[model samples]
Target: MLDANLSTQLKGYLEKLTQPIELAASLDDGAKSAELESLLQEIASLSGKIAYVRKDDDARKPSFAINRVGSDIGVRFAGIPMGHEFTSLVLALLQVGGHPSKASQDVIEQVRTLRGTGSDGVLRFETYFSLSCQNCPDVVQALNLMSVLNPSIQHVAIDGGLFQQEVEARQVMAVPTVFLNGELFESGRMSLEQIVAKLDTGAADREADKIRHKDSFDVLVVGGGPAGAAAAVYAARKGIRTGVAAERFGGQVLDTMSIENFISVPHTEGPKMAAALEQHVREYDVDIMNLQRAQKLIPAREPGGLIEVQLANGASLKSRTVVVSTGARWRQMNVPGEEQYRNKGVAYCPHCDGPLFKGKRVAVIGGGNSGVEAAIDLAGIVNHVTLIEFDSQLRADDVLQRKLRSLDNVTVITSGQTTEVLGDGHKVNGLVYRDRLGGDSHRIELEGVFVQIGLLPNTEWLKGTLALSPRGEIEIDAYGRTSLPGVFAAGDATTVPYKQIVIAMGEGSKAALSAFDHLIRTSAPVEAAVAA
Candidate 1:
């Protein structure tokens, strides 16, 4: 029978294995080597105990009625178990038993060789991932195979959804993420070749620089919207290292149309504004990445204390400070084909892909101001534009509704809800609908469908990473700073009530300025020290 104390002892051993190592360069080589040897010995002792438990279980479960393989190292997972990581549990149990065959032994040795020879001992790597990720299964399988090849490699898989609280505490933005020696490694799926490359460094090179800092900057903006855009243009023209990653790069201007509100610009569309903004930012060589959701902000541990911004993409960027022009998706259509065909044929904004369907029939599926506006725009480019509505009257302002009605090619279909999208392999071809009043069914033939029903902040992905408003927007102060000190947000995703282009643009500028201020106060000392 398996002893009760075995599981407890194993747990204690694993706790030691995963504890983070604090390094001081000034420490003598004897102390450093001693520390490394201690870590390796702890791992070896744990491995031996786990083997004993596995053999004991095999002898006890003779009937095979309840052949349960147990591990002493246990952590609650957050998510579902259906992903590429499903087999990881079984493999981990197998390794703990110590009955691995000769081939398995060879494989394990090879994996060790690949990791490198070191007196400092084994590094424990545990990864957490979700089944929803299509690419996660491949990653899990590769990791499993690697573990079988080398018993020195300790592997643990955690279901992301199951460990919700733990994930939030760690500020995990995406999966699959590997935590090595208690520090976050890479996120997202990586191939076996990539994994090998990551671990193939020499012992001396394995210790990565834990911090980087910078000092002083010319222009620091707080947002990435119109005002932020204008600020970035000015800053880049002055020529210093400037970079911007917003919740979105385009800001609210990308969601607008007929921008007669802007001075001297006459009538302009959201895409046109976004394009101009993109051109302006790029012309001055400002680094920009859209869809880069910022997570936490912390001062660099190094001298000079530059701020470090972590991203959902598992990337860390250091800047003097930042701009906060991250924007939001308009409320979603919440309809069936909306998610599946997003950026395929069903789009939220017309300006981004409208010209691609020039002269083709399309449907604008909403009655809101944005919906009516999209219908008018599509009518100008396509052979026909069908505006479908579930409500009796259009919700757009009188002026906007009248303009939509006046458009020659636009037809408003009322009291109708989109039932299903009709498509083949490539793109959306048509949609089936039902009339709410009379139970009548109809179908429209179109090449594209634009959903303008409403907007939802893309903040859902920021769960646990940032404090969000009850309505799902990123909550920010008047200065555009979020609850997090070094991070800021702007545009429609913020609690900014007006979903207008002009407002978002101004908010972006505000965010950029806040970020700049934060960096200036934090970065200079660190950069100077690094240079010294």
Candidate 2:
């Protein structure tokens, strides 16, 4: 079922296999099993170094194992690898076939050390994931790479849809839910260091006390997304004490897909861009506090006073200035069934989840740039796409509208108000909407729904502390200065008109410069001289 172009690409990637690899599959005689077997055979046929075999394993009827010939590295998939996870399967094969992991040497050594340390038993990592989760691939790949690095550490990615019973039993409410040795480890994207730390501690507290000591900095950044990373880097370049406090480094950017509007770069993905951002910030002397979320911000009492920033982990930071760039998160549709079927089929990211609905009908909510873009993109992957817009006309660009019109499989519906998401108890089946003009209700049968509404700033914690607009965005001046002295804001969290990465970076730089200027003007002659 691979397309010609995809088949050609797979062939090119398969040619890099340095050693022979064997794929052992145990599948019952059924249509789904037959399709999976055929796909595996096709993949094996692409290279001389790869082969497939059928086996009888009653415990895991539809499971498949990939191993280096004559080596005991056991890497297996318990379900059919399709959708976005198809890339995971490809990467696993390549990794098992002698390709080295992209993880840092430090991380690799840590994994090795973890394996060498007297283990209670085989450390099992069961990651529950959905095909549409943008963050799932990274977690799956990280665990899988660790498994390849050390055989004693086993990793299994269980598709939440296929294994609903286990998901409910474990109370997995989110995708990329990781369970270590049958206990919940983490619920979202976690760095390798964080994972290792979690394993080492094995504490029952999900939010373990991480920060122990009070920290101080000249300029403190309160986020770790593109904007905050840029702010930290810019502040550190001035040779000041810079610290960045982040719940997670990437923020909403981690949920983004292929980015074509990042200025100089012709094309890049979210994970790649996030890594570059982190690496760039690490090149400087900035102290990065990952997994530390700002719980409250207390501005300095005096002009030259130090601002105290409280963290979720009970740690506090005192800084001369604080730049708020906590960024924004995907706005959720509060309609019923939306939350119930979140990962079960109601998805926010078209790029991450579209492939899961391949050859199936799906609907795109909203008619703005994101919605139109999602519909257009999903049209190429799914059987049919319905673009729903609440407005009378589409708010997308002319070029985008023209391109969308050219797509035969896409149907655009304006003045359509989504009322409720319809779903079977286990997964999404369809949705109901009302025609604003006629006041008539209608329902469409589809397997998936992509919500591309807009973004809501992550500034709830700053409420009543910072000057925020009615919509909850931080109000800032042209110079990125907030109402509170020694406090600045930027990025989507601020009143910035555009929310693009490039724009956020520029805004972050402006905020950093503004903070530096404030410091220089307010300091004593000796301190000012030193800063200058």
Candidate 3:
């Protein structure tokens, strides 16, 4: 049941309901069922437009469905939709009750016209998730909204922790593992646009057509992380046409667990911060192209000609100046059995996948801040945590190192390099590591292996086009000027000294200014020649 303060807030939210909704619960005589029934009853009391009913017909107990009074379109929940899923529950209620979604009209139309995969022409999706996962809510809410929009589409969000047997049998070692038509659909975090693109095969062509017709921009940003956002904002403030082509808005920041050193803001979550960045960018005149991966950069032929940036979707965007803030991604161990067992006990995100290994032994591979932090976090949930470092000593801050040493269920191993992930064909059961000084191989039985190695810059596409450092980072000058004419680079993708969110933002802003300066100085002669 919800607390009084929560009830009051929920009541206020429920007041937005324009139509009557019903909760059809399938439960049994168990503690979780009783708790769910109480929660449902309490929710029903919040608004007269809501009703709760019990039915023990579903194969999964302690489950419920949200539906409008007279519609077949609905969403289902196979466990208590609390914790991270609480927002998903609220969104389902509002969406089912006729409240409009915040998604773009084009995306909404795409979802509404989707035909489920299969000969049956119906779609049934099941997503396994965990309460502690920060990435699961987006998948659950997106699917629930899709079900509400299309009558033939039905989605049920299942809690992996509550359904332990199913999680083990299916080898669902990660949160947000989605299945469609009883077959594996996708695993890991996904957005509404991404889900629709997967479900509708022909969507790519239509999207590509739309992107191809976009007008040239004055300043185009090729990423949507902290750096790209800052560049877009700075360019837009100058009253010039700006567009951001990003693989995913927020980039690696979306996978971050906690951020406390952002200056001014003492504490914030990654997703929340990402949302704020997107919202702030939206307030400007900048045009955002999400899920767009830059494939190649072709500089303009002339001094003031438009530069072309090719995309992975066979489309391209032209601009007078470009800011490359493509950012970086988590580096993998790349050892044998790592890729084979990914999402089957080998994961890169401890925050997203840690809860699945509750009470199990796990290994954290790395020696830096991220590895130490992941080990400390996993120690609280898992039965045991073994922190393995390639270096002789941990590189984390003194405070963090001190805190890690104080944990009772944690073990630290220095001068260790992860050799291989050991797993059966189904899932991981152990890991192999070697000592640097002793030159001895050791194998430890564990259920999960969380890789917290460093990051790899997203600069492969620009390899032959511009100057790059030995480590594959884009080479830039102090003013953020890249080797290419009229092109600038920023953030983790560039040769900036430190890699931090705040630093990325400042670098992005500087890059945008440099691009603008380049634009004005270069375009004057071209305009003068044309006038003559």
Candidate 4:
């Protein structure tokens, strides 16, 4: 049951319901079942338009579904949704109870038009998730919203921790693993638009067409991380037509778990910060285009002319000034079998996927702060952890190194180069490494491998087109101007010295101002340009 403070807040939300709703539960006499029943009863007591019923029909025990009265539209939760999934449960209740959703009208209409499962047209979705996963809620809420909008679509959010047998049978080693029509649909965080586009084949083309018809912008910002958001807001505030195109809003920051270094904010989660950034960007007149990837950038033929940026969706957006803030992605170990065993037993985020390997042996492949932190975190849940570092000494802070050494279940190896990832053709079995001092090969058998090496810049697309440093980072001047005139770069993709959220935001603002200066100097009227 919810605490007193939470109950009051949930009661306030229940007041928004305009239609009657019922909770259909399939439970037993187990402790979890009793707890779930109590929770459901309490929820029903809070709202006048809600009712609860018990049934023993569902194969999964301790499960319940929120259904709209006189309709088949419903979304289910297979276990106690107390952690990250609590929001999902609340949203499902409100949406199914006839409370208006905040989703855009176009998205709601698109979800309503999506075809359901197979020939029967009954879309049954199952998502296996863990309570500790920060990314799972997005996937759960998106699917739950889709189910609420389309009666033919039904979704069940299952907790992998509660249902161990199903997790094992499905070989689910990641959070937010989704299945549609009893087959693997996708794994990891997904947005409503992403799910709809996948479900509806023609949705992509229709969206591409819409984006293709948009007007040219005065400032076009690529990427949607902290840097891009800042750049877009700064550019739009100058009374210029600003636009932002991102593959996914939030970018690499979404994968980050805890962020304590941001000034003025003592402690905050990555997802929360990303949401705040997006919200701040929306306060301006910037045209936000999500789920769009910039493939290439074409410089203008003449100075002060339009710069065209081509997208992967075959849409091109022209702008007088361009801000390249494409952030970096997790650096992957390209050793043999690493890709084959990915999601099977290899993971990049210990915060998100560490729970999946509870009581198992795992290896952390790095020596920096991230790797040390991952090894220390995994040591608590996993049976044993082997921290492999390419350097002879750890590069993490002295405190972190001291703490890592204090852990009983952790083993450290230095100057060891990962040669190959050995797997059993399905999941990781071990990893092969060579010691730098002795030049002897060694293999450590482990169930999982968490790679925490570093990040690689997303500047591969801009290669040969702009001035790049030896490390592939965009070379920018003090003013954030790149080799190409009117093209400004910022954040991790640029040679900004430091890769931090606060630094990125400052760099983005600087880049936008630099672009504005470039515009006023070169793209202004003849007399005004000369005077400036």
Q: Which runs of model 4 end up more than 4 angstroms from their true locations?
A: 525-532
Off by over 4 Å in 1: 1-224, 230-242, 246-258, 267-307, 319-322, 330-334, 339-361, 380-384, 406-410, 425-429, 434-447, 512-532
Candidates sorted by TM-score, best first: 4, 3, 2, 1
lDDT of 2 by residue, 80-153 (tens): 77776888888999999998877768668778766423456577888877776667888888888888888778
Give the 10-residue window scoring lowest on summed lDDT in candidate 1. 59-68
Tens-place lDDT per residue, model 3, 1-532, is 7988989999999999998999999998899999999999999999999999987779998899988998797899999999889999999999999999999999999988988657877899999998878889989999999998888788999999888888888889998999998899999999999999987888888878999999998899999999999999998887788999999998877877678999999998788899899999999988899989999999999888999999999999999999999999989988999999999999988878888898999999987989998999999889999999999999999889999999999999999989999998889999999999999999999999999999999999998999999999999999999999999999999999899999999999999988878877877423322333
TM-score of 3: 0.96
Candidate with maximal lDDT: 3
Q: How big is the positional error of residue 28 in model 4, measured in Å on the Cα after superposition?
A: 2.8
Rank order (by lDDT, best first): 3, 4, 2, 1
Q: Which is better, 1 or 4, measured by TM-score?
A: 4
lDDT value for model 4: 0.90
How well is each residue in 406-482 modelled by candidate 4, as lDDT tens digits?
Answer: 99999999999999999888788899999999999999999999999999999888987999999899999999999
Sequence-dependent TM-score of model 1: 0.47
Clashing pairs for predicted structure model 2, backbone only? none
Off by over 4 Å in 2: 1-74, 77-123, 126-134, 148-152, 157-190, 193-210, 524-532
Give candidate 4's error at residue 117 in angstroms: 5.5
Worst 10 residues of 4 by lDDT: 523-532
Clashes of each: 45, 0, 0, 0
